[model samples]
Target: TPPDPGDRIPTGFADLDTLTSGGLRPGRMVVVGARPGVGKTLVGTGLARAAAIKGGLPTLFKTLEMGDEE
Candidate 1:
């Protein structure tokens, strides 16, 4: 089925959604990259939270550098 018109998956921030012309497109892969202590984990966790909690979308978060307990 086709996606609903004007449907957008919010990034949990209105400002960022506006900047991206309505958040992320459906079925698209998004990669967030940055130097250490630069909020890469912050952003990834935030997005995952938004997708899972706010948008009710299934999300998977994985990390290679950090351990399960951090």
Candidate 2:
């Protein structure tokens, strides 16, 4: 299905768009660097979830740190 003109766009990061021209565009790569346990994966997951839930776009997540518990 095609996107509706009245649809809302997900900015991924709510606080980020205020500083940039809208927000990250689709099919673009964003490199984020931070110390371990600083929520890098969490942020990525959150963005994917936001796009899926809020924007009605399908999201994919690949975790290199997967374990048997997952």
Candidate 3:
């Protein structure tokens, strides 16, 4: 069956979109974790840029070391 267009937020990466069956679904969580200085922030920013900019959707990138006031 074809995926519902409204159900996805394009990951911007072709491979990611394929692996995710179009893109990340609404109301789901995706975790990218690793040790210090391992490009975790790069990955997070890439996703956020893809969704919020190219894909024109709201995006959030949270960190354990920072908060709304930081």
Candidate 4:
């Protein structure tokens, strides 16, 4: 069955869901900024993976720093 629009968005992290009173709100942007050596790419890739591969939602990732591998 398809997920309902009124249903909650899963954080994919149980602990985070409890802390955030549910999960990330729709139409919200999450920005992760750092001075390099951080895991920004990893997190972004993870989100894309969850949305596309896991949640079955279409995803688009545009990277200016790296070239596409596939």
lDDT of each: 0.82, 0.66, 0.79, 0.61
Best by lDDT: 1
- Taking every candidate in turn, the Cα RMSD to the unseen true structure, in Å, is 1.8, 3.9, 4.2, 4.1
Cand. 1 TM to true fold: 0.81
Write down the lDDT that model 4 would get.
0.61
Across residues 1-70, which tens digit of lDDT does each residue of candidate 2 receive?
Answer: 6644444447577687555555556655555567777887888787778778877778886655557666
Q: Choose 1 or 3, whichever is better by TM-score.
A: 1
Q: Candidate 1: misplaced stretches above 4 Å? A: 2-6
TM-score between candidate 2 and the true structure: 0.63
Ranked by TM-score, top first = 1, 3, 2, 4
**lDDT by residue (tens digit), candidate 1, 1-70:** 8777567778987899999888777777778887778888888888888988888899987766588899
Residue pairs whose backbone atoms clash in candidate 2: none
lDDT against true structure, model 3: 0.79
TM-score of each predicted structure versus truth? 0.81, 0.63, 0.70, 0.56
What lDDT tens digits, residue by residue, belong to model 4 across residues 1-70?
A: 7655455444556686677666555555656566665776776676666656655667665555566773
How high is the lDDT of residue 11 in model 4? 50
Instruction: Give one digit per residue, the lDDT tens place, for model 3 in 1-70.
Output: 6545468877777998999888888666778899977887787788888889876878898877546785
